[model samples]
Target: MPGRLLWTLAAVMLAAGLVAVGLGLRGPAGPPQPPAWAATARPVAHHAPVMARSVPVRVDVPSLGVRAPLVRLGLEPDGSVQVPAADRPGEAGWYDGGPTPGERGPAVLLGHVDSAKGAAVFYELGRLRPGHRIEVGRADGRVAVFTVESVERVPKDRFPTRRMYGPIGHAGLRLVTCGGSFDKDRRSYQDNIIVYASQTAVR
Candidate 1:
């Protein structure tokens, strides 16, 4: 709860690992200005209760038609987050070191914008807007439904490490992927697509 402790955790999360960068991705102009999601049905409120710890089994974003099995991601020997392996069945990975999807803290999810052959899990990640729905099915059989609050594209050099991971007052979810122009020289995208959402409901 202390500010210093919060930032310490955030630093660990950032150093844990970044998402799997795609080989070739089509970058959008940039992240759109975030409008409030308050006008939408079931706007984010503090009424929702945080659930107990449980690993997520799958993730579904109906608006984007994204439904994929979830995989566990953790720190590597080098102290970085492990990249989702190509042979893995899941399209995206959950940062197991952090809180679960429905827990009273930020749940981090990572994915690639594209794969070597073609488009991957988060190919249309930039298209998501405020109020879009994100559902994470937990192993405990309960589903945590989150409503998108904002989406942004920032240069990888300036990724919001603390802002994205420090808060823990409520249940939150962060979906991250590569975006912006691909710097062929660097072999990665110039920016990162980050989706910030909060638990609005549960079942």
Candidate 2:
């Protein structure tokens, strides 16, 4: 699909807000513009050498002590990307429609921050800062190593779809989960936490 349309769909998904994590809480927050890495990040037009496509089977963040098997996720009836099954809140899901790990595009993953039971896969996502490492183990017996560049916590309404999903020449990964304040009445988070990283190696 054309990058433009693909990102538009992703934007729509973000706009709709992730399918609400856990249940019951109250508050609101959002990330600022011009991510910290903006000065160093290459512009979208400069094509980098991206790796061949491969199915990502696992994800790990050593610094945060996060590791999980990846399940494929597709769009919902309303066009929003589906979240992992609520019962399996500890799992993280990859957006099957976008680029695979190591491929030259944004590889999206979504996980719950917390479930009714307790902390979920990406509960510590907000604590991540630039320079952290994220690894994606692919089906072909290779792992794509990515270096964290920024972590953004933004309101659901101000979702930065362009920066998160827009055209890019190098392989990228986005870790997303509900964040900020929770609305007890709405039973949802008022914001989202997005971790941005770029593929730096294949092992």
Candidate 3:
């Protein structure tokens, strides 16, 4: 969202260069850009798991007075969501392949801790502690509640990708957002804070 234009340009440049090369042409053109999604040697599918089309009716965190709508989004080639810009900033979205909230697996929700401008919806997510409650209401009229178990901040360079996105032994929930100090050069947060929770109650 913050650098949408930059990403668009990179994608376009990469696509163009690939097309030219495949046509066996010589290019005295500008530097080639990285592909939008890298062209892997093996086939990879970006398709998300099909789930019942149920709207996120509500999200409630009494400690934060955070009761808001939830949206679903697919991951980018960078493995992160294209966070909504200013108008609908702070909104959270689900990673489709990850588990659903009330089901038996890890459900992931991602939000922007802050945008290029300022604090975003999940700016205070790091403050939550074990035992704090998170409730999600579904369009099907089902409400699921999860209890926080831990909160951790890890550097982006060493982000625990597998632990955060890997298979889980039980029905779990994770809330992720940018944290730690901001990086001026990178124009992004230096760390990512995650909140781990598990299914406690459902209605």
Candidate 4:
């Protein structure tokens, strides 16, 4: 791809959706980062429904002091995920294509590491440590509580699409944002920071 087109797509990916932000491209950098599954050996639990279906209204990461409203996001025409506008960079968005929080599958959420203004939502996402609690408020008057499992930084070229999007027979949540050093030349980050969490309780 041409440099200009690559730059444009990077902008759209990072500024427009979580797919690109979670999946980083491998450039002249070294070997590709290992997949999240390979990075951890703990088995994901398979459980029956713990809560009813409902749209996520807010995400609260008390450890990061983050409390933001969630906007519903869908895929773009090209089949890529859509992200919130730059103007609303402080807000996070839930991918409508996947399972809703507290549901049976992975619920994906995307947010900008920062906007032109300053720090945006998920700026501290990478700081979230294992065992930290993540609470997602649902429209059905329930809150989906998840416990951080693992955090992985992977290159986009090796994005684990099938694994991240695959059905697991249980409730899961994936929080994604751009990571790695920003390449001024490429106008994008070289890696994606992914926070993996599994539903523990809902009320």
Per-prediction count of colliding residue pairs?
Answer: 3, 6, 1, 5
Ranking by lDDT: 1, 2, 4, 3
**lDDT score, candidate 3, position 26:** 14
Q: After superposing candidate 4, which stretches have Cα over 4 Å from the reference?
A: 1-49
The list of candidate 2 runs beyond 4 A from truth reads 1-11, 15-18, 21-49
Model 3 lDDT tens row, 139-197: 78977777777777656666555556555555667777666554445555556667777
Q: Name the lDDT value of residue 190 in candidate 4.
A: 70
What TM-score does candidate 1 get on C-alpha atoms?
0.85
Query: In model 3, how large is the Cα lDDT of residue 131?
Result: 70
lDDT of each: 0.76, 0.75, 0.57, 0.72
lDDT of 1 by residue, 13-125 (tens): 55532433555544444323223342232436757889999999899999989899888988777656665665542489898878999999889988777765467787778
lDDT of 4 by residue, 60-127 (tens): 99998999999998868875778777778778999897789998878889887766666678776777
**Cα lDDT tens digits for candidate 2, 15-81:** 5465674332221232122344432433222233577888889999998898899999988877777
Of 2 and 4, the candidate ranking higher by lDDT:
2
